[model samples]
Target: MAKKHKPRVKAPKTASPGEVMEIKTLISHEMESGQRKDRKTGELIPRQIINRFECKYNGETVFSADMHPAISANPYMAFYVKAGESGELEFLWHDDNGDVYSHSQKLEVA
Candidate 1:
């Protein structure tokens, strides 16, 4: 079984309509590239990494990224979102092994 990962997201609790706000996200994961060998067994460690990341505002995609093996563990990303209305900002991370980590924050736009 894959290990549990912790996802973190930061967004403004309130903002003015049409305002541009900075959003930050981070996930705790050990991104193994599958190229390294086990010290004792001398076997290749299975590759495990976050393969994709996406952000949605009010159910609409705002930002997305495709990650590669070269990405380091605990990936951190920051992006900008233009406030439109009060809604949910959802963050999702897709792992190579069919695992998905998700988090959401409410944004109140006036």
Candidate 2:
């Protein structure tokens, strides 16, 4: 599947080891509920939402969520994580159509 938009992330490029850091993420998604009809065709549009989201640091998953239809479009998330040396922060979003979107950020511990 084609990714509609890239995921947004916020984090310091470098931090002291063991320091707590805040992370923010946002992804653009339609979050359809299957109740909406196409404006031009009037055909019922099937539900399409990001079913799941996962955050991993250095290959270890630290946070995850199951998205529901009630979630608004362009989901936003914020969380905290403890820094431990150098690692990669990976974000993943799974859509209802078996499409997976992912983005990664590199972290450096001072």
Candidate 3:
């Protein structure tokens, strides 16, 4: 079976110059622990999770985290960054299935 990818992000459309902005992100994933059994066959489900998450502003990394299966379904993340005149905020998620999901937001500085 092929891996699936999904991503979500929340970012302000604009911010004042030199101001700080908060960003939130989440990815839809099963986060299976490999220990879980299939309901029908009682077979162990292979572990699957979002192993890494990163945020970049104009190509510079601002925040990042190494996630594990213990996190939760649909891993959620929140972080802050300083906003300057106009730039792009990029979010990335790497899944255990070797799939990478990414999303980006562009904003204006007031």
For candidate 1, write residues 17-54 as lDDT tens digits: 99999998889888899999999999999999999999
Q: For each candidate, give its TM-score against the true structure.
A: 0.93, 0.87, 0.86
Q: List per-prediction Cα lDDT, in the order shown.
A: 0.91, 0.89, 0.85
**Model 2, C-alpha of 106: deviation from truth (Å):** 0.8
Candidate 2 clashes: the total is: 0
C-alpha RMSD values across all candidates: 1.8, 2.1, 2.4
User: After superposition, which runs of candidate 2 have C-alpha atoms over 4 Å from their true positions?
Assistant: 1-3, 39-43
Q: How accurate is candidate 1 locally (lDDT)?
A: 0.91
Each model's backbone clash number: 0, 0, 0
lDDT of 3 by residue, 1-110 (tens): 25455677889989998888888887778888777999999999889888999998899888999998789888899889888768888888988878778999888887
* lDDT tens digits, residue span 13-72, model 2: 788999999989999887897889999999999999998999899999989999898888
Clashing residue pairs in candidate 2 are none
**Top lDDT hit:** 1
